[model samples]
Target: MSPTHTDVPMAPAELDPCGMPDHPDCGIRDVLDRVGDKWSVLVVVELASGPRRFGELQRAVDGISQRMLTLTVRRLERDGLVTRTVYPTVPAQVDYRLTDTGASLTHLVKALADWSLRHREAIAASRHLYDQTHPDHDIR
Candidate 1:
């Protein structure tokens, strides 16, 4: 008889105090490092709408340099989150679009953006209070 699903042993759900796995090869940590980057998040959000050309992405992302955008998209493509297509035009146009996995992450990204907009004022106030309380400790 074949072993049932429940009969299979499972690895312990071990995590540190911060809720992250203690192992260096943790998949969650790798993904978070990729998507949690400021440039990656912005690029993914822009691609969420539809396919866009290299110049369009550079402009829409605001303050991202050409080299940085190139590196960011390459990383996203390597991770299977984005696709790059080249058109056989005189200038050789290139476009970027999110894969299904990347699209799925958009919802969470939008929620985080909304939350930031909502609490920005409160966060600024908190920062001011902290600065006032810790004048000597303020780095800036």
Candidate 2:
């Protein structure tokens, strides 16, 4: 007789002995990596206001390179988080806006930003103290 669903063993890649995902590039990790990227976070925040052109995003994101911004937007597009609209003007303008899914994520992102702002001073002070005590491992 064929094994039942419950009789089948879980794939090794699905979980480790500790019941955690075994693969480094698991779905959750992949999503987290994209969402947690600095450029992606900033791009998402900027798009939260409304649709914006490429140049506007470049300017708004502060230090992102043209190439980096291009990659970030493409990744967001592929992930269904942003939509790119092309306007057939003389210069062929392109604008990016958050999709519904992306918009939903903005609330969580904003909360995280708010939390960072609230704790930044304490975090900085802790970092400074740590750096002072561990001069050999000082990051600054």
Candidate 3:
């Protein structure tokens, strides 16, 4: 039987943690459109090190608001990419870890990061040139 939404895996809520929606035209461009945000990439990288508590993840990711983090975690969990474990304690604690599926995407994320780092200067130069050519427009 074909999977329904409930039967389908979930991704982190805040972002498209599974990368993108399933469809015939779900090309790489579509996947990028879904989870290509800077925040999503950073979160994945941070989670790759190991499981982390909500606060820890927030701190690790940098500049992510609490709401955003919560949403992101939810999406990841729904997508079946991230697993959440809650431990009962004096104040209750929750940790998030990447599932095997999520871990599989780490290499792609890392490669993207590496490529960005390598081409940052060139990208900056391109932006500068574009700005100079079109003073009234910001093409970045």
Candidate 4:
């Protein structure tokens, strides 16, 4: 059987006595640096339901370009957040599943998704107000 979600292992670290990371450039930011890319987060969230084939993932991730998705999945796999499997069919097919470590992140991704949904209206209103006040600025 595949490992359960709770078996996901937390990254071991060398932290200071203050329960902080020892490196000057360490801390949550370091993690964000790895998984913070929007595509990576989306991929994790997408794989939460179960393993998905490459095309399914690309479709489910919405506007992500194929190249971007490939890079994102590769990065996540490199970081031990995902596992890729290839089937030896007449036309070999590949699928990606979250490792135990990656499964642990699903809840956080869900929370983030929930928060975004809840705040969508407020965010749009805020953007409208900002645009009205700064019509001369390029919002993009």
Model 2 lDDT at residue 4: 50
What are the lDDT figures for the candidates, one per model? 0.85, 0.85, 0.77, 0.83
TM-score of every candidate relative to the true structure: 0.81, 0.81, 0.76, 0.79
Residue lDDT tens for model 4, 39-99: 9998998899999999999999999987778778877887789999999997999999999
Off by over 4 Å in 3: 1-34
User: Where does the lowest 10-residue lDDT sum fall in candidate 1?
Assistant: 1-10
> Which regions of candidate 4 fall more than 4 Å away from where they truly are?
1-27
Judged by whole-model lDDT over C-alpha atoms, candidate 3 comes out at 0.77
For model 1, what is the error of residue 14's alpha carbon versus the real structure, in angstroms, after optimal superposition? 20
Tens-digit lDDT string for candidate 1 (19-136):
4556554566557877999999999999999999999999999999877787789878877899999999998988999999999999999999999999999999998999999988
- lDDT tens per residue, model 2, 1-140: 33352232323433223324665444675578778899999999999999999999999999998778887898888788999999989888899999999999999999999999999999999998998889899376
Task: Report the number of clashing residue pairs per model.
Answer: 0, 0, 11, 0
Candidate 2 clashing pairs, residues 3+ apart or interchain: none
Assess candidate 3 and give its TM-score to the true structure.
0.76
